[model samples]
Each structure stands twice: as structure tokens, then as C-alpha cells.
Target: MKIVYKTDTLPHVQQVSELFRSSGIKRPYDDLERLQRMLEHADVTITAWDGYQLVGLARAITDFSYCCYLSDLAVQKEYQQNGIGRNLIRHLRDLLGDEVSLLLISAPSAIDYYPKLDFERTEKAFIIPRQA
Candidate 1:
């Protein structure tokens, strides 16, 4: 198993969407190409692969200086509980270092998961949706 950074791996986007759906996360089926495009400017994207098969993914949007928002993260259901998620978080953190403000909106089920990755709830944090 190896975790590597890749941005143009859109062929694996269908697999990624399936993994998200299985993980109970809502995602557009046609968004694979959209995701591939988004990754073009992403600060970093880490993918866990088992010899060319993508099994997990973690991506973030950042200014490369002040702030970063973890956009999405998912591991194959069969690959869960094997520490892939933790490894993914660590990899992203190392890529960003401590200079950027890292943030993510975790699902209610992941309340415990994010903290395990050293993320904490902030009292002053809030978001106002932007026009689409």
C-alpha cells in the first residue's frame, strides 16, 4: 500500500464517487471530471493505492499561505479501520505544515474521527454559503 499525491487521476473518479456513496456521503456521479478540474488548483491531494487501484483519497483547498479547507476525504469501505484515513490526514498536514489554518466540516459520525487527527471544534467558527 502506498499513499501518493496526484492531480490528474480522473479515471479513478468513478471509483472515488462510489466510495463516497458507500461511505454515506452524497456526491454527484458526474462530478469526477469536475473533481479532476478542481484538483488542478488544489494545494494538495493524497491518494491511497494498492498497485494502481485507488482506495482512498484526501484533498484540500488552500491559499498556500494562510488558510486551508479540507474539501473531501474518503476511503473504500473495505479499506476502512485499517488506519488509511489517519495516514491521509497526516500526509495532508505534513504537506500544509503549521503555517496554514486547516479546517474541515466533519460529518456527525466523524465527530470522533477528526479529533483523532488533532482537529478541534472552534467556538468562533462559522460559514455563510456563497452564491452558486
Candidate 2:
């Protein structure tokens, strides 16, 4: 299973929506326009592709100086056990370098997973929930 990772390519809404659904990451996949805006606004997007298939993705909005909000991280259910998610995080880290710290609001299902990847857990975060 040769999965190639890229930072330059952005997958279509359908591809990302499909991946999100399959990965069980709840997002506005049914709202194609919202998904399109998300893709357009993200400063960093790394995708893992098995040939033409998008198996995993890491999308973030970063200032490239201090902190990065890792807005999304998802991998196809069938591709979960592999190192795709970790590799995707690694890719983000490598790109952001030593100066930036990555922060994400973990899905309930992914709470344990982040720590395994060396993500420090912090209770300091607060968010004004999005109602849409």
C-alpha cells in the first residue's frame, strides 16, 4: 500500500466529504459550499493519496509563526491502523518547524489518539460554539 503524501493538491468536495464520512469525523460534508470554503481558507492542507484515492487528510489554519489550529485530521476507516494519521501530523510539524505549536479540538473518539502522537493535553481551551 503505497500512499503518497502531498501538500500542494486539494481534493474535491466529494472526495473530502467521502473521506470524512468514512473516517467518521463529523463535519459539514453534506454542505458542499461549506466544505469548499473550508478548503479555500485553510492555510495548510496535507493529503495522503493512494494513487488517485484520498485516504487521509490534515487541514489547518496557521500563522506560520506561533500557533496552528489543526482544524481537521481524518483517515479512512480502513486506513486507520496504519501510520497515515501520525505521518500526516508529522508532515504538518515538519512544515511548521520548531516555532509553531499545533492545537486541535479532538473529536470524542480521538481523545486518546492525540496523546499517543505526543500532543500535550490542555484544559485551558475555550470555544464559543458554532451554531449552524
Q: Evaluated with TM-score, which candidate comes out highest?
A: 2
lDDT of 1 by residue, 19-80 (tens): 67766654554577775676565667778776776777787888878888998888877878
The 10-residue segment of model 1 with minimum total lDDT is 3-12
Local error of candidate 2 at 101, Å? 0.6
Per residue, candidate 2 scores C-alpha lDDT tens digits across 1-132 of 999999999999999999999999999889989999999999999999999999999999999999999999999999998999999999999999999999999988889999999999998999998998
How high is the CA lDDT of each candidate model? 0.74, 0.96
For each candidate in turn, the TM-score is 0.80, 0.98
Please identify model 1 stretches exceeding 4 Å from their true place.
1-11, 30-33, 129-132
lDDT of 1 at 21: 70
Note the residue pairs that clash in candidate 1.
none
Q: 51, model 2: CA deviation in Å?
A: 0.7
Query: Could you list the CA RMSD of all candidates, in the order they appear?
Result: 2.8, 0.5
